[model samples]
Target: MKNQNIKVRKHYLLKMAFLALPFTFAACDTEDMLNPVPETSISDKNAFDTPERIIGQVNGLYDAMKDGQYYGGRIVVYNEIRGEEWINRLTNGVTGLQTWQQNVQSGTNEVQNLWGAAYAAINRINVFLQGLEDNKAKIDPTLYTQYQAEAKFLRAVAYHSLVTLYAKPYNADNGASPGLPLRLQAETTTANNDLARSTVAKVYEQILKDLNDAEAGLPLTYGSAVLNTTRAHKNTAIAMKTRVYLHMGNYAKVVSEAQKIVSGTTSFTAPTGVAHALQADVALPFTNYTTTESVFSMPMSDLDAPGTQNQLGYYFNAAPVGNGEYYLNAAGIVNDAQWPATDARKVNFIVTASGNKYLKKFSKPSPFTDYVPVIRYSEVLLNYAEAAARTNDMPKAIALVSAVRKRSDAAYVFPATSFATQQALVDAILKERRIELLGEGFRAMDITRTLQTFPEKTGSGLNAPAVAPSSTDYVWPMPNSELATNKAL
Candidate 1:
């Protein structure tokens, strides 16, 4: 049965390609290029029979994942814009930095690129799911199950990214917090033109459903290290769950999910064999050539391609002196300390000169480097600490946080003898997360979610920048293209 389904899907794909040629050919007027288009679609009735093709398609998804437009481009920009680490005045040739800070509505390439890349991923996943369903008979049962799970995971991830940037936070009371238009089908027709925005709650529910299925269906690990590094797995799904729960202000669930990983209840173990805490040699932590601290990372190579680059290196390193573009404040902020004196992480990764600190997270010299980590074990540890603190498990929270600080050679951990309240603990945790996860595409979402969870923390006078629940800036506006086409939005 599975075999027959594969044959059918292959035939359908071929037919679709043949139908698309007219459009492809029409666009090429005087195309006497090196390569000519073939008249007929390639046949692969047995293409689905091999794990190679399935894996290849999955790899293609990763390629799309790392596109400069999506995580590869705008994600880093988004992170920089939201954090105190960057000042808008220093941003040159950075398209959206001004609009982002002023909270203005503007259409720019960065916004369009991010939107397009996300939809491209969603479209691929939709097509893959559709193909699997069409050819379920020819597919091995286990293979089909795994493929489906992968598709769901990708879909969930795409939606989560979209919602975080383009829609309002879930409000149980209002039920109308603007959300992105949901596109679940592989093919679109005029009949589906009037798609409306799903409430934040609805989108979150879908995200949870997809992740739950992914967690259940994906393998404990993949056979190839490339696959292990590039693709989604059970542990990644588990980690994502912790993220989702945290965003939703479900502290108990965050604690539950993070604890499962931290406690080593299953195959989802912390980076062992080597210490999993921050290193005195800060550079050693980032050198991660043979470590498993990176639970999920996008694979890149020096080879020029659409989705491969050492993004961290390109943005943070000093451009002339090193390769970085932005300079950090060497004297440090009015309230914050400079990068620790003897900590190797700071010494190796940060360049200090003329009262400015430049980033060295990506030690590579060129824009191209292999692999960019999206999530790491260190993040999981912090998530566990934050969640535990929220649930009044201060002792465990302090221990986890202190362990991370000790590794960095910091003086002390949070919830210090002077700080006694939950709010105080939350503030300390937020500060730790900012310092630890700086330039990692988390600050904006953290600020948004925190505002939702604690409306009073929203703070201040009328002109003080609409903080969280009080303002609409919490969610970014949908791309103009989406709004024009999807009336429901």
Candidate 2:
């Protein structure tokens, strides 16, 4: 958004920086990707001079991604608030009041911050990729390919997140609508800042290309559980493809990509690559972030947190556990008769305080350090099930949906009438998504991708009117920072 490069200053390429470094690079403001000061920064010239420095650069890419403004927290909070499930309890301007009310403008702080953070991470990836190639002879060929694939995967993630929020849905007019500026090359200076927006289709093409290359080059499985959960691997790329394809309304492609790792219809387990499958308890992944079910997550620690007022726990949990900025909407899926109170999801993740219900998925106390899930195996199964149902694979769809649902509600069974018609079965699967993925940030994406209106939300003296697909507010506007800095908008 700043039309500038993302540069790291002192101590960024530390050997022990595994997750994030908002503290160590406080002077450099590493999280502010749009405004990097080169005068006192560590030049990319020596970034890859040694193997340790190269590995640090790889970790740096992830640090950019987990900035509080991006995946570390706000992205999840914004997506959930923009949907119908959550109610504004505080109406705090710094938080997502405008977004939850569907009145966000180009100048909105959240809008500009998210846009800048995403591009900041993207520029860092580009810079890393170019440096890796320039210094290929110094590094092992296998490590070079692996690092390149990791950069590409991260780039794909950043681009996809930006497109979903700032551009029209891929399903909208088949992605013919205008998209964000596709900044692929490294931006070490302000010279290359005036690129025009590409079509949504073109942007998606690049995203898919990056993901394909990432899948081919990334390892099948990292040696450790933490690495498998936090880093991009072959299954991570494939799982991301299912999400991307589903967004484009490419059900066939979703199934095709999903089938590579999803081995069985009934059990629904990944046949290879870390042996991903549904955890016996839906709460296990939240408590134990490195569980096999967690395909990809951004890890946090006491030392490196998502920052004050930015953690998911701060927004959702009631006082004592969180700031209680927003509470669950009583009229939302929480009250759905289909999602029984006995369900494991309800029992483990929900809590009531002073007659108000709150989502406790990210329930970590102050300086919330809960890992944020990027994608999970259950979601993969659900995505595959949706694609299968849309493509007339009724049995496969039924089996997959049942697996996800029964995992949380083992005694529950799908009513015979729920599968009587294709529409009925599809509707059932959609509801399951709402129930299963509730506060995990799928609501806005699911609603928009399918061209459904944002359902009206009312409670806690706050009201957000339903936003139809035809409305300008359905998708966020390009940030004012971008308009101010980039000549092309």
Candidate 3:
């Protein structure tokens, strides 16, 4: 009887999910790309009727991405805590205690909520894409193409996030595992909720297809630093492609896609679009989101905050500023001797309070309006270096890794015997990723893609067991909401 009641509740919630519209979209002003005017209602009939409405719809897509359950904060926190980097201090269920312990079930709040939010965003994108096609005559041809590209880029990001959490890593059986439902059509009703999961390879195929299409249609640059940082431009798609290809263990494809933006070996920079290069100071990008180094980040402002509970600061910061739900695990990456105390990445981001260390990358107090980084030029460089290492391009790999490391710790140098072989160089680059992307959410993805064990750790009297690749907890289960409605699941 309890199970039947739960199913009924899930089915009803799934139906309601289709009807939840995005926040009111506002037209961009001459000075700002996302000055959203809240509290306005937008009907489907008028969603793409004018240029302003079309622009608003595109902005709406980003707004969806920044939802508390997705990139805004929870996804980032979930990804990090699932790895061995952090210890659950508060053990707050509302945050991610289950995820920290590697015991998340199908009925877990994050499991169900994140899945629902991602598909909601995807469905919204599908609806917007369909609307654009249906009303093509109303918008400029160039604008129409750009908007479609943006939608596809967003859809690709959403699908990628879903797959990473719910399915096996691409390296696992080369993506032979069961994946997401791959919903590409606009879903305004629950009539078509009986879709089956696609193979992981098929989902990745769709992701690459979207990215390739996005790269072709997206503009070279948005002209505004804010726009370039926040919006999907040609380089943005190319950078994302490198990440996707790397996840698939396709080093050749990663190098190919990375070359579109990245140039030179000794000193890497994006030759054409936006002139992306490593920030002289690694902390510069964090201080200001609209920098050349930030390839793409989700924008945040006081008007559109990523909720109190969802703020990254709220998770990793201490009292008077944040709740300090999770703190750096003593046995984690902070213990690495390679990551010296003088390293800017460490000095600037890590804070010690109550005899515990916390990551302060998202340091905005209270409301925590820090722009969540989605991808950065530094990550692109590391991605290139890793792929180059795997492909035996040792010189290029060493140069790229050195460039990234020296940007943060100017005087630091790699050991003489570190690059003795390709694997050694790759190992150093991977360690750099752990330091460079500490709290920015690359931990679990890096772990799973490399097929490493989720290392055991203890905090707050809770011991998280190590999860091997064969463990059922290696990947999250299909959410109960999905199972209740999708008979094909």
Candidate 4:
């Protein structure tokens, strides 16, 4: 069954490839790839008349989301380049340690690939939403709402990620902060090429609105076993809200959302009949796709699949069978020791050999496995801790932190003398996040957002040497292709 899904995904990718070429050639300038369609010819009379058709269209959006160009490849590349983990393999011979801080004029494939892929997903989501609306009455109203909510969530997520990486952080005091171009409709013609950037706050407002609508419409849980882990549920919506709130520095909202999941008081329930817990046998959580820990994951299958497979382990692990892109060294291991020795979460998740520690989060030997997680349960606990500490609920914060720590048999108690203030506690939580969530495509966002909240770092080691926005190193420049086409940057 999983193999069938892989084949379907490959077929969808082929269709997208063929569909994208005309647009790709038409634009000439790659940056115009994300322009919104002023008018879509797709009408409500013909789409979603059958269950099979609607399902296929929805599946296409998921396939686009998993494209190596998007989450599978360049998105991870952007995350790694900005973070402390694996340095650019191409820059190894270069002298400067700050090679990642290069200007957008560098025109690296990594940058172009990321920009193109994000727009591609946005385009796909736009098409799906248009189809669903056109055939609203022809489809089951419940399924129609669910599919629309899902596409909206995906679109909002893609846009949010693009704005964060492509533009500056949102400043409430400054209404002029540049944000990514807002592309809400599906473009099918050449006239939609002209586009302009929106403000950061405006972009975030759209993201929040989509999430709110999705939470209200999505089911508490998926009805089918095959769909539960693979599809977004009410809890997934809540989990994403927690993350978005955290980035926005809304501690009260973060705490409210996270606590709902952490205590199992809300719509979220651990996958029934799955007794999966944080395993004590290994240092890191196993990359098992069926685990209860996953809030949502893209399902992959087939050892010879066509699309991007689970190559995270293959790329990061030490030599022999693995590609030695960023082999762990002594310094890497020492920096990673932030994970306590007794924490089994650290052992199985990271491979320590030859004095280097390789990330083993997705250790499956097969090359063709689906591997993208938008959110996970472990992140929920961390969110609760950070938000509680920020809100002056030290006891609640410590308890949440300890719940995760105790799972791995690591030290669950924080000394009362360790942090005298809420700010200090927040620092500890951030450090824990860096080590725990490394290589999961979050370090860069965390770094940028943290610097925004705590400008002063006299005591907090996390911010002692901060990366400033004005510094070329803080943000990746607009891709040269994008700059050339839009000319707005």
Candidate 5:
């Protein structure tokens, strides 16, 4: 057994001495971006050194991800609000709802928060990589390799998120769009602060490179199987690759990569020797600890609770258990004829009180310490199904999609004749993604990739004079803060 001390070890990076130099930091403390690390006191002497601390730095990277700004909530909440699967009564000062209804300009808080939070995490990962490289001679080769792989995986995740929110979808003009500043090296000097945006193609190229290394480097297991799902492992990198390939519209790669985690030639069975599988009771872990379906989940210790103000539960759950600022879009799911009323998701994943239908997927009472799902097995299945359908593997696509559907409810299972063409199968797979992964921050990307129109929300107490995927409002404007700081953007 792995030492419990190592498996459960947690570190708070923001509270500790961060990359003591701005050269390794993504952005220096400026008037606009968060100066999360007080650079004034940071120095080489205070930065992470000893080999044992490398693991701590790795854990610190998780702390950066645990921020409600990213996995803690906003990422998922923002993605859902932008899609038709949710509704909000926005006049009650719900900026979350307004993110979709009103075209938030470059100056909006959403742009700033999402951009700032993501880079902050990226910078931390960069520092971890730099530190790991420097101390490689002192650390065990096995452990050092794991640390390096996990750090790169986290960095890739951050960049993938950055590009997804700031630039158009990868297929958009084949990634000709401007992407976020791709800072591969650790930033330490002011000269590197005002970097320019890279082409979306270049950003994705780097993301894939990192994930590829992670896939090759991360160990098959992290000793503790439960923690394996929370930390970077071989499957973590593979699952994330599936997501990246899906976003890039690389159907064949998506199918091939997903197959490594899921048993193929057999449709939906979890692969032998792989830990991931569809949870028998899908809702159990959302309120508890890590589970098999989770490839990588954000583990937030009690002391490091994803702060109350921006937590996902606050946005989706009701007052007694949450903020209840939003509710499930009845027309999208509850009343949609395509979705069976008796599905396990509705019976266990949602809650209704005083005539209000709310999604309780992220609900974990006030402190909301529930582990956040980053990439899960079912999603990989959906990705594989979509890719397989598009690549002419009809039986595989139909079986893959049906596996997920039947897991929730046999009644919703697809009929053999349900899809007659590749497009029909793809459409059904996409719908399954919507049903299975709602409120997990996928709707926006799916909409952008598929060029689906915004749902035109009703009762949001907000107005949109205009909305379109091709419009500037579709993706976040480089936040005014970044624009003012990085002139090249």
Candidate 6:
């Protein structure tokens, strides 16, 4: 076990001109928070002279979020492997992610980094919002409002990621469990770090508020397809809201929010200015960055690769190109007869060799640089379908699920009389979610929210011999390093 102090400072701000430059400023790198400050630290007040300068700060927010520890890889892979969807291939020099498979203590690097990186990004979003509010007079009203909304979206995203891991599921006794330390303010040196943890209810309230604000202020499109996918947009926040509400067991709200994105159509077509819809080819989203389906994909390029060890390929692609750190859960999806054999996803996504199944969805070559999908329209439709089932809208549920299901396996679309009961339709929706979002990072959260027990309790590498239905092991403890310093916890 190791300790990491997530010291959040504003020195890492890139100049507005640097945003136009090359790879140098593409990825955000974090220095040890406890380390000596760089002499180049900019005063928060002066960091942005022009409104354009703030864009650099906003861009850097995504980079911090794209921290291989979070959206980059571990954040997605850790959650997926924890459930039965994948068997962690631990023999290939297992260190970083093996701890996740083992379900290590709070001090483990995987959990620590996930905590540290999210807070670091959250802190940056705070300062960015604070700076914008303080300097609103100097900036264009339109740009100022947009960035404010964007910062809140990023902040809500960071907090949501943090709480999902560090605390119980949002519906845990209806969010009565202790959530994260609500660090909403921009921390200066004088501000006390000893803030108390908020209840899951309060944390969710804040998350919804941020998302609602973000949705109201964001536009349908930004500068480019790349920028539109990377940054927060109206649909991005709406897509996120569906996930949040779905987790909270607010099925009506989930259907309500998701409908804003999917509209009345069962399939999600990119509306007017939006370039998002389900990619006709299942693998196109990961391989070609943005597709009609990408609601919010954290952007990665040659200029901004997620780096060597932290790259997603190191964990997923195994055949001839990758180290093959993890493989698909055979009983779950790899060879399941229920999953149509001719399913395009099965043919294109499930990669197998020597009886082991590795997923190719994250298959960017070494120096892995696959643009991580944060929230795709596919998930939005699934969310809508799940909510529809819960609300007893049988036709909508069956139709929505079938619409998404047919994209990957046209031969397997449900018949008109299929799914006789709500439970049956919900079951189909749950299976679709796990298969459709395999490497895209929605498995463990789905498992927890649905009150299902983790299936990989017994495994070779890092799994506990016997995990029961009520084990606290599913909930990550607050990191020891932070507790030592923050008395309020």
lDDT of 1 at 255: 84
Winner on TM-score between 1 and 2 is 2
lDDT of 4 at 294: 67
Relative to the true structure, candidate 6 reaches a TM of 0.89
Per-residue C-alpha lDDT of model 4 across residues 436-488, encoded as one tens digit per residue: 66666786787776654212222111212345666654565666555544445
lDDT of 4 at 241: 85
lDDT (C-alpha) at residue 368 in model 4: 31
Please give the RMSD of candidate 5 to the true structure: 8.1
For each candidate in the order shown, give its overall lDDT on alpha carbons.
Answer: 0.60, 0.86, 0.87, 0.61, 0.74, 0.74
Candidate 3 clash pair list: none
Segments in model 2 whose C-alpha atoms lie over 4 Å from true places: 1-42
| Candidate 6 C-alpha lDDT tens digits along 158-222 | 88888887888877699998999998877544245678999998999999999999988887788
Per-residue CA lDDT of model 3 for 1-489, tens digit only, reads: 778956665665454344345334343344443453222222465567788887888898888888888889889989999999999987789899999999999899999988888887888888889888999999899999999999999999989888988999999898899999999987655567689999999999999999989999999998999999999999999999999999999999999988888898667889888989887877788878899999999888899899869988889877767889999999988979889998888888888999999888778888988889999999999999999999999999999999988887889988877799888889999999999898888999999999999999998799999999999999999988778767887
Model 1, 320-353: lDDT tens digits are 5344445553222212653345544555566664
Question: Model 4: clashing residue pairs?
Answer: 44-134, 282-344, 283-344, 283-345, 283-346, 283-347, 283-348, 284-345, 284-349, 300-370
Clashing pairs in 6: 102-462, 276-292, 277-292, 277-293
Ten-residue stretch with the least lDDT total in model 1: 455-464
Kindly list the per-residue Cα lDDT of model 5 for residues 1-489, writing each as its tens digit.
235322321111222224322232332345424444243234443234565455666777777876777777788778888877667753443347458575777767777777767777787677668777776787789888888888889989989887887898888788998887898777544446668889999999999999999988888876675678678888888889999998898988997888788885533555644567877776765855566777778776568787856777777777798877887776676566677778888787788866778888876787877677788888988898899998999989888888888877876657555698888888888888888988788888888877666767665454433357778777777876566555566
Q: How do all models score by TM-score?
A: 0.80, 0.92, 0.94, 0.80, 0.89, 0.89
Give the per-residue Cα lDDT of candidate 2 at 171: 87
lDDT of 2 by residue, 264-338 (tens): 756877888889999998999999999999999999999999998889899988889899888888888889889
Which stretches of candidate 4 lie above 4 Å from their native place?
Answer: 1-49, 87-106, 171-176, 224-226, 264-285, 303-310, 329-338, 366-370, 410-412, 415-417, 452-467, 487-489
Sorted on TM-score, highest at the top, how do the candidates line up? 3, 2, 5, 6, 4, 1
Model 1, stretches more than 4 Å misplaced? 1-50, 89-95, 104-106, 171-176, 188-193, 223-226, 264-282, 304-310, 321-324, 329-335, 410-419, 452-469
The numbered model that scores best in TM-score is 3
In model 5, the runs with Cα more than 4 Å from the true position are 1-41, 90-95, 264-267, 270-273, 415-417, 464-466
| Model 5 error, position 422 (Å) | 1.4
